[model samples]
Target: MIDINSWPLYVQLAFGLGPFVIGFSGGGILVFTTLRHYDRIVSSFPNSRGVQNVLRIFANYGFHPRSMQVAAIAGIVLFPRMCIRRGELEPEEVRNFPPEIKRLMVIFTTLLGVGLAWVALAVVLLKLSGGN
Candidate 1:
């Protein structure tokens, strides 16, 4: 059990924000990917409007903003153990995603950083203003 109180302020702040960052990263990818492949994703589901609506709702909120945070925590706990037991990824294995997908990833990463900073600034301003 690490002593958080003994840690520097920056480290304490990072510990607080780390989950937000991870969740945002995951949520950003989910949002960008879903929007980019909206047609293809929707087409794969049933043609019924009712089913489609349900799926749409799920797609919109299933990977909602904080979902990525949960996923990040799960991955932190599960991925490393899986990797150690299964061995590392092969050197020859590579993701040959389409150019558009690559572009979306780059765009989303930039947007996520900007968004996080913006949100942080807004929160600080709100607090400074005493929630007025």
Candidate 2:
């Protein structure tokens, strides 16, 4: 197998730092957007059973409902920007998203971003450790 130690220090640092940066920054954006969207929904429909059900599901997954709610809102706010950057979505699509579904999307995207960052960090650390 090829020796990772032979690689330059910049490469190693990039491998180490890239994921953490993406995870923390991207995750923060997602969490912020999701919470804002949730607040909007709650304000508009205080008696929304659907919202309660959604929160219940998040709680079942071992998340604090309030924190998850905020993350969900952040994710919603960040997704359009992400999708546009990736060329997977257009500005028009953002305008067409229903408020409730937008909140759900945020939650999904935030979790996905966090998971990706964790995985990237793991790979980088493994490489740095010379584990192959």
Candidate 3:
């Protein structure tokens, strides 16, 4: 078996921290986007009680799916630099993505986590079984 303990400190550190860094960064952005989405929803339809109620129900029921998408988007953007290059957001402007887009991000983020885990598990299993 390949000796992980023999690997350089940096390689070990990368293996240990890479997934977590991605997960934490992606998760943070997911939460941030969700909050911004909520704010937009509240501000955009403050006068509509029915719409607000409906949205509230959806939010409560749809958290997981929404979180997944946000994570995926965070992975893609990683930082605002991509957005700046694409002209999606100005340096001075706050992100106020629409609710629909926010919903999509949540779902994607959740799926991204699942996919990452699956691949990681597969690699570990293959290594353990002496498969290249």
Model 2 agreement with the true structure over 70-113: per-residue lDDT tens digits: 55433434544664565544455456556665655555565567
Ranking by TM-score: 2, 3, 1
Error of 2 at 78 (Å): 12
Evaluated at residue 86, the lDDT of candidate 2 is: 59
| Model 1: CA > 4 A from native | 1-3, 47-53, 56-132
User: Is candidate 2 or 3 superior in lDDT?
Assistant: 2
Sorted on lDDT, highest at the top, how do the candidates line up?
A: 2, 3, 1
Give the lDDT of residue 33 in candidate 2: 50
- Stretches of candidate 2 exceeding 4 Å from the true structure: 43-50, 57-64, 70-132
- CA shift at 116, candidate 1, in angstroms? 16
- TM-score for all models, in order of appearance: 0.37, 0.49, 0.43
Model 3 misplaced stretches (Cα beyond 4 Å): 39-115, 118-132
Q: Candidate 1, TM-score vs. the true structure?
A: 0.37
lDDT: which is higher, 1 or 2? 2
Worst 10 residues of 1 by lDDT: 88-97
Alpha carbon lDDT of each predicted model = 0.46, 0.55, 0.54
Instruction: Please provide, for model 3 over 1-132, each residue's C-alpha lDDT reduced to its tens digit, 9 standing for 90 to 100.
Output: 665667799987776666676666556656666665644534543443433444444454466745543343344333556656665434443245354654545554765585578559647955875667
